[model samples]
Target: MTRSTLPIWRRIEFTVLLAALTVGGGIWGFVELLEVARDKTAHSFDTRILLAFRTPGDPSDPIGPGWVEEAMRDLTALGSTAILLFIVVTVLLYLLLDGKRRAALFILLAVAGGQVLSSFLKLGVERPRPDLVSHMAEVYTLSFPSGHAMLSAVTYLTLGSLMAHILQRRTLKIYVLSVAVIATLLVGISRVYLGVHWPTDVLAGWCAGTAWAMLCWLIAHGLQSSRARPLD
Candidate 1:
């Protein structure tokens, strides 16, 4: 039988298993990347990839036309602290007003906790911003895992999964989830294009951020399964 056709409890068990696997894999990938990032042994690889986005001789001039740079900056802002906070608060308020208090609280805890965790990781790693190219976008924080990348994944993925859960149609659910993934990816790429993050920084951000989101889902699903009937 297809997974969706399984007994409700069986489906829940399968989902929990998949999410746990994802969390474990993400954590493992992030740790391996972290060691490379810490040792600076990946400098050559990082530099080569970073420069690929710039003109052959001009690291200051990103490879795109002027408008493209502006566009990337705009894309990058979608992951900014201000934008993410606004999105989270808006969603939280909507969920509360709609009587989904549990969901609202979960979103708040997931995003806010992810933000705090990202800060701790950055501070602990103390990796410097990439100096291989002139930064096209302004930045003030220390760089290890790109904050924009990690937070975007955390926020968007959490929101996406919630959206998937709410939608009635399978296609609609897939569409929303795809949009979330694409948005998260674009933000990471924009950071590289803007020369604000090393390639590994973005990779680590994606790994950790995805793990955090999945971890949140696993917790929520487990709690819900415990409280609800098996048929639910």
Candidate 2:
């Protein structure tokens, strides 16, 4: 049969395959980054990127107009714990009110579990914040994998995927998913630019978070698909 004639379930099967590949890639990337995090090359790379955002003569001043720095700070805040919590609570409330109690609970648990995972990874790695350049933001935590980057990816991607499932229009679904990806990238970049996280930290965070989000999606999708399948 031609592509246009393929059943919707076939398309869903393709998506499941793709998501599985993504999960594997993300996990592999995270592991490789973890292995190299303490090496000389990684250190050099991290410092070079961190200092690139700073003025040549002074690492204290970022290489940008004042407003640029301010904007970066604002972007980084999008991934802040407080902001993320607020977003989650709002979504949970909406889902519950809309009689999607199961979805609400699943989302809450996913986000909360992601938060816990991030914390555990931080403790396991115990990497210190970058000191090669002046910090543009205040931080008090280990920095192997950036919590901002990881949590933002987890929260935004999870919400976006869920929203896409509910949205009827293909265009709307794509737009929501795109926004989630862009938001996650911006948050990670902001962390590096602010000299609070090493480049590797953000990369590792992205890998771990993407893997986690995709895994959750796979599980949920599988459960729903099984329920919808007709008895043989």
Candidate 3:
């Protein structure tokens, strides 16, 4: 069918499929790179690069061990509460302002679904964390995909996208999105810097989380559009 004649749901499905393919391909490429890094010669090259940028557990800088420790403590302290608050506030805002309850539902589904997927992937992969340094926090789960990274991407990016739709100024919207993206990146990096996760773990988390978030957005948008359209 022609573009104009094609159904909206079908277009949305096509877009979602394309997004899945792109994310899957990127993840596969990253896995291949990790495999290459496992080789002795290739491993040495990777190790040198990592060492060049390594911050040797200094307690001085804001991004150093002391800061990371405090941040992790704060994150753990506010973890469940923050998630609950995020859900409650988003739902209330959507209901009161735009009556877009679907947006709030989408955010919950995306983040929760991503969490489940990340957990399953981590268990299946069963990758262990690096033992090169002392971990700042204790963790017993598999380390292939960082939960913090996945949740950060899902929560921050989803909220940022929703905010973008509501906000008027293009620059303000872009700034919000940029901050979300940067925060997601920094949180993921913090896990690695704290010696709690492998670099590959964070990368995989970001890819999977982003893909799931986009999928949820596509679904929510498609539903909203359908509701707006007149009956056949």
TM-score, cand. 2 vs. native: 0.90
lDDT of 2 by residue, 1-232 (tens): 9866888767657778888898999999999989877664447777788889889979899988999999999999999999999999998888888877777877887788888988888887767777788889999998888999999999998888866766679999999999999999999999999999999999999999998888878877776668642111
Candidate 2 lDDT: 0.86
Among the numbered candidates, top lDDT falls to: 1
Better of 1 and 3 by lDDT: 1
Model 3 TM-score? Answer: 0.69
RMSD (Cα, Å) for all candidates, in order, is 3.7, 4.0, 5.6
Residue 54, candidate 1: Cα error in Å is 0.5
Window of ten residues with lowest summed lDDT in model 2: 223-232
- In model 2, the Cα lDDT at residue 198 comes to 93
Candidate 2 stretches with Cα past 4 Å from truth are 1-12, 40-42, 228-232
To one decimal, what is the Cα RMSD in angstroms of model 1 from the true structure? 3.7
Better of 2 and 3 by TM-score: 2
What is the C-alpha lDDT profile of model 1 across 1-232, one tens digit per residue?
Answer: 9988988777666667888899999899899888978885557879899999999999999997899999999999999989998999998888888877877877788888988988888887878888878999889998889999999999999888765665679999899889999999999999999999999999999999999988987777666657552112
Model 2 collision count? 0
Task: Give lDDT per model, in order.
Answer: 0.87, 0.86, 0.61
Candidate 3 per-residue C-alpha lDDT over 1-232 given as tens digits, one digit per residue, 9 for 90 to 100: 7877888766655655765675676567546645643443424443443343356463222244466567755553222337635754765576457665555565566666766776676675655666655676677777666777777777677666655655679999899879778877877766765566666667777776676666665555555567552111
What's the residue-level lDDT of 198 in candidate 1? Answer: 93
lDDT at residue 182 of model 2 (Cα atoms): 99
